[model samples]
Target: MTAPTTMPKFSKENSERRRIAKQARRLSLRVLIVCGAAETEKQYLEGVKGLYRNPAVAVKIKTRDKSPLEVVRYAAAFSKSDKDDFDEVWAVFDVDEFDIAEAVREAAKSNVNVAVSNPCFEFWLLLHFVNRRGHLNSYKQANALLCKHLRDYDKAQLDFANFQDKIDIACARAKDIDETREKPYANPSSGMWRVIGQISPGSHA
Candidate 1:
C-alpha cells in the first residue's frame, strides 16, 4: 500500500486570523432560516443572496428527525466566531405545531437576542417583499391592511396574497421611484429600506 495520506494541519493562530477576516466582512443581525427542504431552501437562498450578503440558513430538524437542539447548537457555534461579530440572531422556521417558539427562545437565550419567522416557508418570500424594496419596519400592518390600500387607491381587485407582487408592480410603474416615498439607501426617509418592521407579522421568535 502507498504511504498513508495525512490531513493538512492548520495552525490555530492562522485559523483564528482567517476567521476574524471573515467576521469583519459579515453583517450584523445575522439570520438563520430552518427551512424544510433542500430544494425549497435553495430557492429562497438564491433570492435572499440577491439582496443580503451571506445570510446563513439551516433546516427545521436538529438532524434526521432528532431534536432541534442539534441544529440550534450548530448555528450558535457558527455564529460565535468572535462573539461580537453579530448583533442579533434570527431562527426562522415554519410553524410546525411543535413548540418551535420555545425551542428558539431557549436556543437564543444564552448568546444573543433571537427572532423567528413563523410559517418559515413564506418567510423566504416575505423577505422578497418586505426587505428588498425597503426595510419592513417603516410599514407596520401593511400586510393586514393591504386590501384597504388597494381599495383606497382604486385597485380593489388586488389581494394580500399578491401584495408583494403588487408592491413590486407599483415600484416598476413609478419608474422614477419617488426617493421621498420609497428610498433604497437604508434611510427610512429616503430609500426603499423602510419596510423592515411594519409588514411582517408572521415573523416572531
Candidate 2:
C-alpha cells in the first residue's frame, strides 16, 4: 500500500489576495458624463471613446437641460442610486451664465467630478489646432477660430479625425494653461482633459 499522500500548505489569505487582484484586472471603468445633452460635447466624447476602442473602459453620455447645480445633483444622485452604477460620474458644463461655485461645492459633497470649460467647450477643441494664449470673449469667437482650422466645422457631425492625431498636443497645451492660471476654470481654461485622461491607455482608474 502506498504511503498516505501529504497535503501541500496553502495560505487562504494569499488565495483571497490573488483573487482580488485578478478581479481588479478584469474590472472595467464605467464613466457617466452629464453634459446637458449638448451635441458637440456628446459627439466629441463619443469620438474619443471610439478612437480608443478599449474593452476595459466604457463611457456613457447623458444630457440635461437643467441648471448647472441641478445637473451636478442629478449626476450625484444617479451615481448613488445603484450598486452597479458608474464608477465615475462627471458634470460637464460651461460657466457662461451660471454661478458654478455652488455646483462645484455640491459635487464635492456628492462625490461627483466636474469638467467645466470657461467661455465654452469649443476652446478645448480649438486647442487641437493651436495653442491659444488669451481669453476667448465668447463661444462665438472660439467657434470662429476653430472653423478657420476645421473646415465645415459642425457640432452635429462627430468627425474628429482631423483632431485625433493632435490630441496629445491639445492635452499638453491645456495642462500648461491650467498650471499657469490661478483659477483653472476661468476663461480660456478647461478641465475636460481630466476626464479624458482617465480613459487613456495605461490608466488604472
Candidate 3:
C-alpha cells in the first residue's frame, strides 16, 4: 500500500497580509513632483516618502536645476504627456529672483499644483523646528536659520530623520503662515505642506 501524502497547512497571517497589500495597491494615488533644485528638494521629498511608507501613495521626484517658471512649464508638459501615469503633478520651486507670478498662473492654467517656498526650500525645513515669521532675504538666510535648529544642516545632503517626528508641527506652522499671507509667494512661507498633506494625510490632519 502507498503511504498517504500530508498536505501543507496555510497560514492565515500571510494570507491577510497579501490581501491588505493588494487593497492598498488598488487604492494607491500616483503623484509626480518636479523639483527646481538638483538635490535639496529631491532629497527632502524622498525622505518624506520614506517616512510615511504609505502603500496607498506613490511618489516620483524629478530634479531640474531651473528657474521657477521653467520648472512649472516642464512639469506641465510632463503631466500632459503622462496623463495616465500620474494622478497628480506638482512643481516644487523657490521664490528666489524668479518672476513667479507668471509661473503660478501657468501652473493653474495647466492644471499643475505648485509648492513654492520663499527665499529657498530651506525655509520649509526650518518650519519643522520653529515658527519663524521673519522675512528671509535670501536662500543663505533661510539656510542659516535652519542650521540653528539643525547644527549640522547641509543642503547637498539632508537627514530626514531629524524632521520626521516634527512633520505635523511643521505642517501646522506652514499653514498658519500661508493663511496670513496676501500673496502666495510671500517671504518666509512654504507651500510644501500642501503636497505633504496629500502624501500622508494623517500628518497634515
**What's model 2's TM-score?**
0.82
What does candidate 1 score on TM?
Answer: 0.36
> Could you tell me how far off, in angstroms, the CA of residue 86 lies in candidate 1 after the best superposition?
3.8
| RMSD list, candidates in order | 12.9, 7.2, 5.6
| TM-scores of the candidates in the order shown | 0.36, 0.82, 0.83
Over the stretch 1-205, how does candidate 2's per-residue lDDT look in tens digits?
9999999999999999999876854598888888854587877887888888666777777777677898899888777774546888999888776788999999899889999887888888998889997977888898899999987888777577877888888889888889999875878888888888888776754
The CA lDDT at 62 in model 3 is 90
Tens-digit lDDT track of model 3 for 21-119: 867655788788999998988988898898887766878889778988889899888877874477789999998888799989999998899999998
* Top lDDT model: 3
Q: After superposing candidate 3, which stretches have Cα over 4 Å from the reference?
A: 1-26, 201-205
Q: On residues 105-141, what C-alpha lDDT tens digit does candidate 1 reach at each position?
A: 6665755232223323332233334443343332233
Provide the lowest-lDDT 10-residue window in model 2. 76-85
* Residue 203, model 1, lDDT: 25
Q: In model 2, what is the error at residue 62, expressed in angstroms?
A: 1.6
